[model samples]
Target: MKYIKLAAVVVAASISGCATILSEDVATVNVATSTGKKIDITIDGQNYTVPGVVKLEKDGQSKIISTNDADCASSTAMNRKVEGVFWVNLLSGGLFGSTTDSATDAMWTYDDYVTISCK
Candidate 1:
């Protein structure tokens, strides 16, 4: 019975938040404009719009932003972060957790939102 309990604990720990424990190769960034207008963005040559979300790989690609608003100006690159569950998995010995996270691109996360100035 003790062994079963221990095994259950190990399995639970290993599978917990597996998506967020291993992978972070992509991120979905929510973009917005200062004037509440839609804006255009180019990341590594891929075009996107603002007041919307874009899913991007975290492989060092940077956002090159633009807006139709003549007044609006510059913007910053989107941010990336390791998921909080990453540490938990690490501490739990991960085992299969790390593998799942890596395969599913859940080990990392991106900032939920960003804004661009058009003035």
Candidate 2:
């Protein structure tokens, strides 16, 4: 009976340990026109909007991709949840403008990898 109680306690501790951890990595890609116009971005068939005021460098440089830790519900036992917002830009004639009005949100599972692209 004592051994059974101890075994139960160990099982509970193991389960608790697995329930409170989360982690994720995020990547972003930027595409720009040769004339320094707007940038186009698409991820998983979704369009993202970037501000026109933010112009791509003259030499067409890609923005530095970043990763961050995501918060998750401890009681829900989520190993990882990727969540964030991003933007994309579009150019029209000699003027630049934002193709979309608001930032878009993205989410991923613990084992999922997110890729962003410009076309």
Candidate 3:
């Protein structure tokens, strides 16, 4: 019984980071245009149409949405913010959990929705 309990604790501790457990390397974000026009935008060198959801990697780096279309305006998405669960894990699960989240880059998150301006 003692060995079983110890093993369980070890497993829990190894996977305790809330952000690491809950978040993924990619997050889906809603992209839209102020003019409500459907246009192609480039993100991370990948072309995507606005007014849709795009899966972006949580790399802790800023992202800019650009387009060759003359009628649409480019937009910048700032650096990802620390996930709320990261803080909670830090306070409750301590440094081990928080560190795991940081190392995995699961602690980072971007805005749920972004809008690009257009003419």
Candidate 4:
């Protein structure tokens, strides 16, 4: 009887740990522009005005411009939720000789609910 109880306890602990790992919230956002034109971007209902000359980092690996109030809040929330890293990028055309003014697709991921905004 004691052996059976120990096994049951072990199984329960394993299941709980697995559940914790699976409960992390994560999401991704993709943005793209044409002609390298600057436009306002909205993610999760927040808006941000990104300049054509600025290249937003695709993942959390690069320096991020946290000037936007909403984007700053979102980043903070994400940092508290998941143990993994997130990314964001801007898709740009190959023209302009690798200039920041090129158009490109932007991608970003959040480990939890994030609000991004720019003005």
For lDDT, the strongest prediction is 3
lDDT of 2: 0.27
Estimate every model's Cα lDDT from 0 to 1: 0.67, 0.27, 0.84, 0.32
Per-residue C-alpha lDDT of model 1 across residues 15-95, encoded as one tens digit per residue: 756555344557777778777877676666688877798878755334555544456665466655667776677676776
**lDDT, model 4:** 0.32
User: Tens digit of lDDT per residue, candidate 3, span 1-119?
Assistant: 99999999998886677898877878789988888999998988988987999999998777888887777775656457888889988888568888888888889988889888788
- lDDT for model 1, on a 0 to 1 scale? 0.67
Lowest lDDT sum, 10 consecutive residues, model 3, at 71-80
Q: How many clashes would you count in candidate 1? A: 11
Question: 8-95, model 4: which lDDT tens digit per residue?
Answer: 9865543332212322222332332323334564433455664422222333232222433332322322232222211111122222
- Model 3: how far is 65 from its true place, Å? 0.9
A best-first ranking of the candidates according to their lDDT comes to 3, 1, 4, 2
Top-TM-score structure, candidate number: 3
lDDT of 2 by residue, 1-119 (tens): 99999999865543331111221123232323334333343323344443122222111112332212122111111133332211112222211112111112122223222232222
Off by over 4 Å in 3: 1-15
**Model 1 / residue 44 / CA error / Å:** 2.1
lDDT at residue 57 of model 4 (Cα atoms): 31
